[model samples]
Target: MITTKLYNRYQTVIPSEIRKKISVDPDSIVEWTINEKGKVELEFRKRLTEKDIIGLIKQELPYNSVEIKKRSGRGLDWE
Candidate 1:
């Protein structure tokens, strides 16, 4: 098992082996979780950008500004 010492501020450098295996960079996000058995887990994810979520919302109908204004007048938000 690879081991590293935690500094006074509780910060520890990730070993090169682990870093290479996970392919994490400075911009990567690290998620920490504890299971029922109290085992800690680490997951790495890429940071999200506007381009990544541009089309996340599915559109079934065509866009209509008039319909949007009417819906807004009726207090409907994104129906």
Candidate 2:
């Protein structure tokens, strides 16, 4: 297991190997959780952007203008 020293400020750098594996970089949100079994888990949270949403629609959603209109309720209108 990889180990790191906690500094005076209670801060520790994540190991480079682990960071690379998780695709974490500067400005990434880090999440910490402690389970009932006393196991601690660290995770990197990825925030979705507008570009990501567009890409998801392009890739996964089929063109359904009627369903889109019903679900959106004038949201797509340019008023």
Candidate 3:
């Protein structure tokens, strides 16, 4: 098992081995939880970006920004 020392501010750096194994990065979100058996769990998740949701919405046709503006009555010059 990997071990790390808690510093004065009650903070500990996750070990490199564990970080690499979990693919943790600077932008990763850490979730801490305690199971019913009192075992601490750490979940690492990457922060979602626009690129991640690009294809989340199913579309029958390619997105057209101009068409969207026209439908919204904002005109092609919409800022």
Highest lDDT: which candidate? 1
Candidates' RMSD to native: 7.5, 7.9, 7.2
Candidate 3 stretches greater than 4 Å from native: 59-79
Tell me each candidate's TM-score.
Answer: 0.62, 0.57, 0.65
lDDT of each residue in 1-79, candidate 2, tens digit only:
9999999999999899999998887868888999999999877978754434543544453555555555566556432
Local error of candidate 3 at 73, Å?
24
Residues 25-61, candidate 3, lDDT per residue (tens digit)? 9999999999999999988889886457566789897
Residue 12 lDDT (model 3): 91
The residue pairs in collision within model 2 are: none
**Backbone clash total, candidate 3:** 0
The residue ranges of model 1 lying beyond 4 angstroms of the native Cα positions read 54-79
Candidate 3 local distance difference test against the native: 0.78
| lDDT accuracy of residue 57 in candidate 3 | 82
lDDT of each candidate versus the true structure: 0.80, 0.73, 0.78
Model 2, residue 77: C-alpha shift (Å): 23
